[model samples]
Target: MKKIIALLFGALLLLADTEFAEPKPSIDNPRKIVFPITHGDDESINHVLSSANNVMKFYGPEKVMIAIICYSKGIRTLLKKEKKIAARVRSLMTYDVEFIACGNTMRTKNIKKEDLIEGVEIVTAGIVELVERDLKGWIYIRP
Candidate 1:
């Protein structure tokens, strides 16, 4: 019985090893994830940031690509005026996390490119950007 139990434990250990499916994530083929932030509230913004950070921590920054698409009220998160939040964003950017802003939202809210944090990419439309990324096989996460 003891030998059998040990054998079973070894088999379980072998099964516990991490496994990746087709197109496995690696330095050359990293996992792509897009996060959409539509809410401007502090909690919501922080939550999304936290989620991205957690993913990076799990996969290691080099093994994963993360993009945060901000539109509508969510554009507030990319504003330079959001001091605390902007700092957090900047920190994430160091890890290669991309933050994208919607041009339509900026125009609607009278927000200029200079008003946003340096390094933010502006797209014609945030929703459309999300759609394109999805179609490209990037995971869409709304946290």
Candidate 2:
């Protein structure tokens, strides 16, 4: 009787975990991903791009929607002067990946729209955008 009771409890816990499990990507539906970048280093920026590239490759560009949000020092990754990585950025854009620049960081860092890459979008706050996307069931990745 005790063994049966323990097994029942274990089953209940498994059921509970599934009830609150994180959302999984669906091939039939558009896979949503939001990556928040707060570091300005080349290594960090490259990782973010590589992850997005891998996901798009795996899912096919049309099947996945990717957004990379930059704030703090990370905003440098989207600047027009980021020559070292500009080509890579443009390459990702061809896959329809979005690059978001935080307006608050731009203001503090004195970055204008012209200072950013042509396709970059400006959002009021990066953290808030990440939070909203996560709550909406989008996968969040930071590298």
Winning model by lDDT: 1
Model 2 misplacement above 4 A: 1-28
Collision pairs in model 1: none
Q: Candidates' TM-scores?
A: 0.86, 0.80
lDDT (tens digit, per residue) of candidate 1 on 9-106: 99999889677787878899999999999999999999999999999998899999999999999999999999999999999999999999999999
Candidate 1, which segments miss by more than 4 Å at Cα?
Answer: 1-19
lDDT of 2 by residue, 59-95 (tens): 7887789999999999989988899778888899998
RMSD of each: 4.9, 7.5
